[model samples]
Target: MFIDAIGTQHNPATDARIISLVPSITELLFDMGLGGNLVGRTAFCVHPKEQVKQVKSIGGTKQVNLEKVKKLKATHLIVNIDENPKELVEELSKLIPHIVVTHPNKPADNIDLFSLIGNIFDRKGEAARLISELQAAQTQAQLSAMELDEKKVLYFIWKEPWMTIAPETYISQSLKIANMITYPQESDIRYPEIDLETGILDQVDAVLFSSEPFLFKSEHLKEFAQTYKVPADKLHIIDGEMTSWYGSRAIQGLRYLSDFAKGL
Candidate 1:
């Protein structure tokens, strides 16, 4: 029954009381029609507003209320490897069955992860439906965007020290499918600090700043534009989840990216 190195037991038939530590996973649970089984969720999980309001908030991904989590007596605790610390996982694992899902930041790999979640929740039909929808939307977005002629774009995740989506990252792959070229396409690191002055930023047709990892507001974008002397319209602040989170919600990303491209 053990799934991986973490000693997570698989119970595809059980309708256990579940708590989700990551927002993306929480959304997945709801998407799979298992929302009724969710007893607790982190504050960061605000996808379906109704579910967010109903579930008890243990805390954010980085900081969890262990006492509250323990008291909830959840049969299954779902966590993301990148969200929680190892020590916390170990501590929680001792108290209850903890399922640690490794974050998949690549476009194709995300499909595999979703399938895995489907198996865990015993909702393969729902998962397959979502995957088909995503694939169809992705195809449509790609076809429509291609008519405009692909534009070179840079997706920024952080600003204090500029960091962008690196090559092989999910965002980068998604951008490529949307017919947008990303700068620094050779780096394998998911997120990397970029040199703005080395002709890298100059070659891009536009720059997209994410509202997470570092919330990039209009002021921040203006500052960046002024500092870089780029056009104001070229700088955009995008929803972080639409660009970063690759899960059941990714089907929504294709539509979001399609709309964003219309603006550009």
Candidate 2:
């Protein structure tokens, strides 16, 4: 069978040894009922903790131990487009079958990507189920969010330089579907650096801090709240997976967003 990007084919039924380089794709593999086939995973693929415990970790997505990967005899090596360097993928391409999963920063792009992954892994039925579920969840989130008249919110991914989600990003789309507006909705950059002196924070109704890249905790939220003079209740520390990962993990995102809407 032909897979996207990575031009490698093997008997889907017999290709039992697999290595996942991306956390989202690893979660998808598990969701597709291929958890038993996973032989190795990156250190970052920590979902389904039990399954993760069973697999050997090569390293992080950007710094995989190629020697260890080769020694593991992995039949398939799945890498994310942005997470793994292209040179490394090219090098690994010569050793084993590699599948490159392009990161979809927008919700719209995710449609075809999900279908492609399903087709590649011969899990079309599960993919369809997941797609249907996501579509339904999106609809529910939209409807629930529409009922609220909350002000525009700003979502920060990093703290040091203050990086935020852009208008066309997946997180922005999810927030929009949930009826929440982003502060800089027209910015073309998917992840842009924000200027603290720009008075942009004054326009936002709430600030959401994600737990990734920069792990924001209650103390971090308190600092922002004190600095901006915004209420502590306005700062929400959200799960990064819910706002980011565009796979089966999104099934959980819908539920979390729905609950967030109810709270609003």
> lDDT tens digits, residues 10-100, model 2?
3444455788888888888888787888888989899888877888998887887878888987767777665688887777777776555
TM-score of 2: 0.88
- What ranges in model 1 sit over 4 Å off? 1-9
Model 1's lDDT to the true fold?
Answer: 0.77
Which regions of candidate 2 are displaced past 4 Å?
A: 1-16, 108-110
RMSD of each: 2.5, 2.6
Clashes of 2: 0
Highest lDDT model number: 1
Candidate 2 achieves a global lDDT of 0.77
Quote the positional error of residue 132 for candidate 2 in Å. 2.5
